[model samples]
Target: MAMQGTLLEFILGWLMIPWRIFVEIYRHAFPPANEAGEHEHEGMLDASSGDITIDKRELSHWTKLSQQWWDPEGDFALLHGFNHCRIPMILDAYSKYIAQKPLPDTNPLRGAKIIDVGCGAGFVSEPLREYGADITGVDMVPAVIELAKAHWNERHPTEIGPDYLCTSVEEISSQRPEEFDMVLCLEVLDHVANWKEFAAQSCRLLRPGGCAIFSTINRTLAALIIAIIGGEHLLRIVPMDTHHLRKFIKPSEVEYELNKHGLVQVNLTGCTPVDPWARRPRWSDVSYCGVTYAITAVKRA
Candidate 1:
């Protein structure tokens, strides 16, 4: 059995060679939109001012997944399990760095004002609400925003959960600058056409000394193999076109953007699966940040 398993692994590895070569050829032929200077005009909603960051392709892609957003055993199963790692990180960061106090056993995040940008179907928002945080969940996709609202209403009929909004982060930042105590922008950086602007607006939403947390895939060969090829194609864990290789932002890029926006980098942690089959993520060291990682930054007071 062991020999057979090894042979199977070897065969699979060999089979992936062609796919890998194809990916490299495609990458060289058509570089990242930003690198190729396509962002000069492409993905711009308004050519006059060029302030909008909504990628229509990304928006349409997510809209197709709106109905499956809440399905745990469906395409978003990984995201559902990912809450276990991210929620704790949020709570700990707020308590240690922001509040500078011990978290209460119950209602740990009471009185905390948080905004969940790119919040799909209120998955993260609902958990934060249970921990007593006042959350406002926002998404560019109208269908998912409505789905988030409907789900939140169904689950918490009497108690008000997160306030769901179908709006871009740029618009929200302009409307309510420096209003939130914490900003949660998980798994969003890679999807935006203008990640720098998207990140800037996310940081702008935070009050002085407020924390902004972000999670995204690193732009690396490992990420291409695992995230794009293995996860999307072989395992079929997520839908194809869910992620683009060129759009994956490096951790250094994230840190630079935060620092440029007057936010200091606080924490950077790598997240990896517990096992080959498990969806549960375990926190790893920075060296393992090739696949997925999370960043925590605080606005300078």
Candidate 2:
């Protein structure tokens, strides 16, 4: 059995050599540009000018999947299962760092205002709302926002739920600067054209001392194989082209951007699937972050 396992490992390692070479060539051919020059040549720069983070390609891809946003057994099942771990991380961070008080057993987040950036069909927003949070779910995709609203309405016929908006985080920050207790940008950092600008705007939306939570896949060869090749191609978990290689940001890069915007890192945790087939993620150590990770930061007072 040991010999067989070793042979399998050797075979896999040999198979990955070609992918490693391709990654190197891709990186060298299209070297990451500085923040000022990033995506300028690709015609990806949004005309809206100041801190516009929307990527048209990404928008179109998500728009096509808007109808499947709430399907637990469909394309986004991995994301739906992600809520189990991310929700607790959000609550723990808020209670420990932002709230600084022991929360009540019921409605722990009662009266807490949260902005769910890139909130697709209210997946994260709906759960947080159930915990008594006042959530505003913002997404650039119109169809998903509508779906979110319809789903919320169906779920709560007598009571209102999260405020679903069809807009960008930059627009929201401009209108309601420093108003929220928490800003969540889960699975969104890699999708934006300009992550620095997106991080800045996300931080701007938070009130002083408020928490900002972000989750994204790391830029590494492991991520390339698992997230893009395996998940998108072999397993067909997420839609094709849902992620791009060049857009994935490293954890250190995220911390640097958030720190520049006056947000201090409080916690960083890695998340990965429980198994290849199940695809359900669980919180793990930072060492496992070569694939996917979540970070919590607090804006300075």
lDDT of 1 at 23: 76
- Against the reference, the lDDT scores of all candidates come to 0.81, 0.80
- Which regions in candidate 2 have their CA more than 4 angstroms from the true location? 1-36, 39-45, 48-51, 279-287
Cα lDDT for residue 292, candidate 2? 91
Q: List the residue pairs that clash in candidate 2.
A: none
Q: What is the per-residue lDDT of model 2 for residues 53-167, given as tens digits with 9 covering 90 to 100?
A: 7777777888888887777666777788787778888888889987898888899999999999999899899989999999999998898899999998898888879999998
Please give the distance, in angstroms, between residue 131's alpha carbon in candidate 2 and its true position after superposition: 0.9
TM per candidate: 0.88, 0.86
Q: After superposition, how far is residue 246 of candidate 2 from its true place, in Å?
A: 1.1
lDDT of 1 at 24: 53
How well is each residue in 138-170 modelled by candidate 1, as lDDT tens digits? 998899988988888898899987888988888
Model 2 TM-score?
A: 0.86
